[model samples]
Target: MPSISRSTPMRCAATSKRPGCRRSACRAPRRTGSITCGGRTSAANCPTTAARCSPGGAALGEAPDVVFVVADGLSAFAAAKQALPLLSAVRPKLEGWRIGPVVVARQARVALGDEIGELLGARLVAMLIGERPGLSSPDSLGVYLTYAPKVGCHDAQRNCVSNVRPEGLPYDAAAHKLHYLLTHARRLGLTGVGLKDDSDALLPAARTEAERLAAE
Candidate 1:
């Protein structure tokens, strides 16, 4: 298992004149004009993923092209407890077929999906996580998919499908969007901004479903 840290320095786009500017915390520049820093660098507002922290070993006997992971948070069975019902409902729909290993990562984070997928040698990884309870929807769930996951992979590289709940994004619709992105990500060899959500167009009655869901 590799030690994962959220402290990895990333490129900073902020100008030097920005308020509370500190240069000492930043690392050496990789690309000129972009500053590297551990805190408050360019895109500092974005969340960071762990560096490595993968435990499951490499893929065994016909590795799955895509791996689905369930990582609950620090709370007592919070992730699993919340995810089980959804999983149970979704499992039958996903039955029969070469769907990759479904790893139950209890007490884990979103980054763990990347690590495990990399370890398993999977081309793509989709991790379902429990979101913190908001006043609107207490049982919100989030899904994240990464292509070619490995150590040091950034959060930006992953595609996220969030607000998966009864009132929010429905389970069936979320599954469709995930399937659509997974296929396209493998084809394009990427996931973030470059890959647009044209999955709606691929589906019948595009505008109806598109208007109904909040994928963005």
Candidate 2:
């Protein structure tokens, strides 16, 4: 599904590092006019609506650092009603050189993100997918990041961050991990099994500060 486009960067001021639910009604009023999608006003009131893609298709400007595409397991109609909205809500906070919306069909596979990313000429691509509901975890989001995405890239060439939700990985932590991976991916010019996530390790300066503070 195509969605509206925005020139403004995505930033959430109220977001905090503590683990807490981040779900809030689309509260930020639009400073700029709405971008239409499918001949209708982008759901500006609903955060997701702001990122809701135009069903008719939208053009890509300069390739963004990352492009987020949604692939949900729900029926097309139902996914459009639910998944798209949720992903759209995060569009504003997704800081990058540029980003755009992409909607995939129901039951789509991970390869779709690669194809879309290659087509859009993005340096990297992140796919937000809905995982099957489980007894303990009913709603979970899975993220896959592919560097230099193109058709025929193997799954081993991508990096995955899974079990993301309010009760699980927490949005802030997930974003931090994603940012870490993206930064390293661009510098190393690669992603997948070879790349490692060491973001949890304390920095040298932080470790020194911790020891000094402890001594006091």
Candidate 3:
């Protein structure tokens, strides 16, 4: 695993990627791990299939072209009520998206990548999750973006947006950035280690603003 002391790239983009990996490289299932999100445990790790962390089955209706892994805390539901508005503005572009139930997991960040990708046939995935609680902040939300979805995708092809509490990366801002990166990754045909960050082009103004705000 790489250290967290590295300086990376792009304003809206994030992750450690492995472009060399093929889908066949990892055929393992997500290890049995546990996590607590949105006051519930991960469905993937559920003792029974009926208790799945995600919403499924034909009765729930057709799966959208996209799957959203929402890691929730007890308060994530409320935070998401505020956060969804931020994502809602971009819904038109992500026309086939289906925001599902919040899933708790032992390692939710990566679990979301595999879960979202397989269900949606997506080449790339973005997880809007609840960060682990800290002394100073517990309500904070985050986004982890990645390429090439699969189980055991540790440190492989991705980035994250942290501190989405009232003072951190706000919902509207984060949503814009997420969409921008996803589009660029798709258009460039880049993912994993090969994914170039084109987010700088889409939101130079925002990056500058983010920097300016952080510096303040």
Best by TM-score: 1
Assess the local accuracy of residue 142 in candidate 1 as a C-alpha lDDT between 0 and 100.
84
lDDT of 3 by residue, 75-183 (tens): 4543443334444544556644443322223233345445445444556656666666676666676666666565555554666666654345555566676777666
The best-first sequence of candidates by lDDT reads: 1, 2, 3
Instruction: Estimate, for each residue in 79-196, the C-alpha lDDT of model 2 and write its tens digit.
Output: 3333334344445455544654343433445666676677667899887676667767566767789999887788899998776665565555566667778779988999999889
Best candidate, lDDT: 1
The clash count of every prediction, one per candidate, is 2, 7, 17
Better of 1 and 2 by lDDT: 1
Model 1: per-residue lDDT, tens digit, 112-160?
A: 6777777767888777787877766567778888988876667789888
Taking all chains together, each candidate's TM-score versus the true structure is: 0.63, 0.60, 0.55
> Which pairs of residues have clashing backbones in candidate 2?
1-103, 2-53, 2-54, 3-52, 3-53, 3-54, 10-92
Instruction: Give model 1's clash tally.
Output: 2
Write down the lDDT of every candidate, Cα atoms only.
Answer: 0.57, 0.56, 0.46
Q: How do these models rank on TM-score, best leading?
A: 1, 2, 3
